[model samples]
Target: MTNKKRLELTWIGKDKRPKLEPRILLEDVARSYHAKHLVTDNDIFDNRLIFGDNLLALKALEQEFSGKVKCVYIDPPFNTQQAFEHYDDGLEHSIWLGLIRDRIDIIRNLISEDGTLFVHIDDNELGYLIVLLDEIFGRQNRITVVSFKQGAATGHKAINPGVVSTSNFIVLYAKNKTLWKPNRVFTARNKRDTRYGQFIDNFDAPYAQWRFITLTQAFARSLNLPIRGLKKAVGDSYEALLSDFVVANAPRVVRLARPDYDAVSGDARSMIDASHKTSEILRLEREEFSDMFFVAGERILFYSDKLKLIDGKYVAGEPLTTIWDDLLSNNIHNEGGIEFPKGKKPEALIKRCFELATIDGDLVLDSFAGSGTTGAVAHKMGRRWIMVELGEHCHTHIIPRLQKVIDGEDKGGVTEATGWKGGGGFRYYRIAPSLLDKDKWGNWVISKEYNAAQLTEALCKLEGFTYAPSDTLYWQQGHSTERDFIYITTQTLGADQLHALSEDVGTERSLLVLCSAFRGNPERFTNLTVKRIPSTVLSKCEWRHDDYSLILQNLPMAQREEETLKKKKSAHPSLFDNQDA
Candidate 1:
């Protein structure tokens, strides 16, 4: 279906906005809800993760958090035939598309102007997914498809199976391509003797034989440098030279090389005199080594242009890339042994993401939040993070792993890999109920725990208001610019209350007094936008009726040229899933 049609199906007219109801029991609905924490008053720039169907969570977030996210990385299910076990995957093709598209549309709204979204998928639906993303994020915002190696080797199959295995594609889309900058992975210069030392003979001729040999030998001997380098060349002769120099420099040795030689003569005495400049020789070697040798570290330490040292702090260097192969993924895999089903993402990958996306104190978010990788990395890197998970494994697997990170218990891998000192902690939270049910007249009657005030607060949340008072008193709407003094009171509003509210509102701003019953004709008050209670507040909520999912499911077949065109229009057209629906 066209994007225009999708928008037409989802858009709600302003006049169709729902009214409040008095009999509706919004309390019971609120009570059934549960949450470990609420970020209601906290600063949002700090990281946050909302746990629920990404669709509902996105909608819930849209009102207050539009255009706020910086970078979003989602490793969504590839929709391959492989069993996910938990999620429903057997739905019609159009249903899956509709589901994914709905969430993508919402996700597009949440990205900040400079933000980018990375969608991970396999070859199966990559093309279809790209087209869908283009439709939502705009063709102009599309970025590169980064190929990530998934497997090391391909198992033997009948037809020429000697190739390296598969790779997953990361389809990146930016809110605005002009404002997006892809993070770069750090690169190291080849320092291995096998790879680079062979090029040593390629040095300039003037510096290769005499200058190189004499300077290198003298410096190496004075510094007591490893003899291994010189062992290959002038072996016995080089040691004899070192013995001569050591004895000549020794305090007790006198007339060792030449006796009866004038101190100022242009003979071997002059050579011995110049050779006594030991500090100068050592200085030249130290300078050369510092310029040539490179050490592999988490942060790239390179030669700086500045020669002066101010307070021993080195000036900042250019930022590094995110592609980190320094720590071998195989080493981590061998140690961990893939005991957990979801398994742990490499600490190097996690650290790389953290270094690119945030700084010390910035918040990182991971909604998939398996095993608390984001939280653990963020804590070690001195960044804050919020993680969300929807399985029992959160407590059993994720929490314990994160605890190890905080207490510095699991020290070997991440610490050695990223040079991270483990510290910091986080409070966990679950999404809670936002509304209650109703009886008949939509009356705001308390059934169990929540009262009329609590129901009103829930209504405010449902209506996209960020703040709700517990007293059910008149307070200006916190989020909306047009509306002020939104109230949710079941008690009948008397003339006294209205007059008092009017007095409090004064002539400065218009008042939106919402109550179960107004004592007088609301039309008579020209300034008040009074709303009566016991009306449908969630009139815009509706089940998706479109067949977009079927289209998505059958995309692979449709894209294949060999497929029969006759099946193009069928509801479940894919040849892969041709069995009974």
Candidate 2:
């Protein structure tokens, strides 16, 4: 057997991972919005809209949201080599890959075992993105690359010099392909199928007594038109009139085709053979399927079977394909009462993603939420969603757009299709300022931006505990489990204070205490493990680091850090070599 491995798309800083600060999220209740009352029983009001760097925002969400999100859709700013109003669309290729790689790593963690991810990009970095995602999501888990035709190459676009680029690509991957449940989505057609032109005049009659006639003659009779003068009477409207009639009388009008005898069941084959042998019009009834009718060794297929309910109308439909050209972004500039111009994705496009990957009340996440299209569409479709945006427009654009969606004032973009009467809400949050900051003395300290409660919550996250403070118990600021608890305070603790906390915790439970400073031999208090706050967490992460990025300039710094780690391991060999010991 040949040993094989996935090929990686390597670039600068691919190995150097960030010691990310899992900062806490602080809600801005004033910016949050909801309807006065519920529009429906299933309305969701707990969606999140985070206004901060998306990478950091995703980190803030992981502790609580990991393995929970059902679908993630990111329309990330790519290397377009052109600047837009709300985005820096161009970045160095290596840096872009690094940026995407960091976010993708966290995104995979957020995706549940049965969840999926979809990313929209053009051809420029499509090859690299595909390889990167394949390596991360596993080659076998990749679903498909959809060629989304956003616009037509007509009018001004047709006059362009080279092949006009009216379409980009959406790359899809599942967290675990085996566990994913794909909803069979279909594409709808506006008109009826012409093949179902034969009508059964005696459909209600018993077998061997049925009569057949042309559907056109039946339709003419229904319209009280003379069979010979049908074309002349309808004139230019003949096709439209006939199409409406066929759709209305779809069950009676059908096209007969020979069934594959080898593929059909024995009972159906018997009926088919009987119909051919005599003047018998045979029929077979199936509980899960429509009754099958045989006529001269052929199966009658009804036009109604091809119809699908699309946008409140039943029209002909086919299984959706990878090449999607129906979702057009035309005249949607004023949609959502704001404009991000080049960055705004079509609501229909996001709706398609949700329909494929989610059901009602599923959680959806979009980190690169330009114009909040994902949230807007998810709301209409009744899926709970969280959107993160680093741009100033998170307030200027997203909040206002969502308010309109909840208020029922926005009447465009999927509202009609989903029949949205609008009643859901979202809270506004910003990634709290990095936990630690430099002071006047040039020492790392907890920032003044954090109150006592905020600092306790932040330290809970850093210490790998859920931030669930108990109202009755002061020491139970958070907990990893019911038996394990943590307490945080800005005040220094003495032997007496430690004794009080230990007694409250009791021998049945354990508490990890974090404070400004602690005195005495804390090991004596069997259940308490006291440690200094800023000192204990100092070496755990890069303090005062508010932003995370992988840039070309940092390559040498990464090298130096790698060398330092290697030297430390060499000095203490057992620390690196023996894991179980």
Best by lDDT: 2
Off-target runs (Cα >4 Å) in candidate 2 are 1-5, 206-208, 227-229, 548-581
Q: What pairs collide in candidate 2? A: none
Model 1: weakest 10-residue lDDT segment is 192-201
TM per prediction = 0.62, 0.91
- After superposing candidate 1 on the true structure, give the runs of residues whose Cα lies further than 4 Å from its correct spot: 1-50, 85-93, 154-164, 182-184, 189-339, 342-344, 434-454, 468-479, 534-536, 542-581
Q: Residue 316 lDDT in model 1?
A: 19
lDDT of 2 at 197: 74
Of the candidates shown, which would achieve the greatest TM-score relative to the real structure?
2
- True lDDT of residue 99, candidate 2: 86
